[model samples]
Target: MDARVIILLLFSGVCLTSAGLDKYSFINERKTWFDAQEYCRSRNGDLASARNKEDIILMTDITGWTESWIGLNDLNRETMDLYPNSWRWSTETKSRSGYMNFAPGEPNYANKEEECVDIWTEGTWSDGECSSLLNFVCFSGPSTDKTYHHINLNETWASAKNYCRTYYTDLAMIENEEENQQASSNVTDPAWIGLSRRAWTYSEATNQSFRRWWSYEPDNRSGKQFCASVYKNGFSDMGCTSKLPFLCSDGIARKQSRIKIMIQSNLYLTNQHNKDNMLQQLSASLTRAGQTDFNLSWSTLPQKLDPASLNDDHQ
Candidate 1:
């Protein structure tokens, strides 16, 4: 083969390799401990099975210390595993990997019940109860809500419901096709809603009150359910795990009014301050000009000098 052709082929091969590596990448989101593992498994990967302190730190920085659920769990204590020691991450069906970056004296298996895993700071791992509420991390993919807000930060389903109640109304009860599209467009994370079969019957009588799922029917046989949340493009059954994101809405009119008031207040304050500063400067100039003589008794100036007229030109 010609030398030029050989060089061109080598360059093309390098570009293909780089693109393939990039294709294997994934983004992360908050999820329940169990769900996070399941998510990793479903994707043919596990919650970043890091193997060193550097890897842990890298993940923490990327996830903003937001506390995401990893693949580690001790649900099967039948294997003679302790809390932290028994902690092993499920790679789903991926290859087994190890990342031992633990805190000082960590993986001590403090409590038998503490089987779930989480990353604290850097590569450090800690054992937490699977049921205990904590932020979770899930690999990124299409989600329910399309937009997100800061007010939706770190809240459980129950807590989110209450928050919406005390501040505004109930958890966002998505209704109609328009609302569904709006909800999907505004989700940065999965959010809890008010559509659960645990609290009420999903029969024909109450069908009007609940949001419909886009796909699979949730196993709502048990009545322990009391909340609902948006996932993918439809709603889903979820426990009140502190691992999901939430949604809050401000009616467009109310939000616009508030914004207008804020703008008006800011303008008023700025103008008032400017007026005061101008007055002070004028007063100083008058004093320096030896115009104190003009500060006569009120009787001297029968017609009060209009303060507004006292400009630089008048001075």
Candidate 2:
């Protein structure tokens, strides 16, 4: 009589492809934002993230300067914190915050839609809708006399920012009490200032601050313009259901691979149940080791060991 032996085959490791910056493609077909997202994902991509002015330029050039959907959106903002992380100054040089002068019970974030700030009272701030038309203040040079200029123009926050940038340096960046007082001077009503924030972010959640907004864009006039779309001038918030062509971005390159490992085991390797248990154990070990991207599986059949070899091994 001769004894038989089985050698188990295990597939281990995963395929990885490191990616640089995202590469975008213009899909001329019109689809709603959700449909477009699904289509791009089917093609191993997502809606585009125009990370900077240069990227926006490239995207516009590719789309022939047409209105198209991008991945930036604020759909999930209702559940996000309306605190320090979300608020930002329109001016790039302005610090996040140093001096604080908020009207009592200010920034109540009213209905989670008031992402923009305004001078609710003299030298005090309150959150307001970005779409509200109000007088605004502009700033230039430094926090000196006559640096902050009050403009009696009834415009939205985005429009005010653009108006200030076109004429003065930018919207008023009230860093301290003096600047805040200057920004609020002679203002008897709530006015738009440089301080405002939008909850929009890219699908991939990249931490890039680059944005190229069209004048008065992202006004959130309908309060439902949670999705971002690119136009000839720049980007604007749009309703997600609006049908439009979109840009799909290949986030990172990836590939599939397989590696083999031989396991000499005396256990019943032919049992499908045993193989499944082994795979689960291996997967758990890999996950614990911080290698989550890989998958594990066993080959369909085991290699038969030579009779002589099995006898020698049993000796």
Candidate whose lDDT is highest: 2
Q: Name the runs in model 1 displaced over 4 angstroms.
A: 1-28, 78-241, 244-315
**For model 1, how does the per-residue alpha-carbon lDDT over 1-315 read when each residue is reduced to its tens digit?**
111100000001111111122121234555654565456556554443222344344444444544343322223232332322233222111112222434565434346444444444232345544444433222111122212122435554445544644543334333244433443343444333332212222211111122444366444425232234433333455443547433211111111010001111222322434334333333334444532212111011223444334222110
Best by TM-score: 2
- List residue ranges in candidate 2 displaced over 4 A: 1-82, 143-146, 200-315
**Considering summed lDDT, which 10 consecutive residues are worst modelled in model 2?**
306-315
For all candidates in order, the CA lDDT equals: 0.33, 0.69
Judge candidate 2 at residue 225 and give its lDDT.
82
Tens-place lDDT per residue, model 2, 116-206, is 8888555788879999899998876533333778898899998998898788767777777777777787788888887776577676444
Error of 1 at 143 (Å): 48
Report the error of model 1 at residue 274, Å. Answer: 95
Candidate 1 residue-pair clash tally? 19
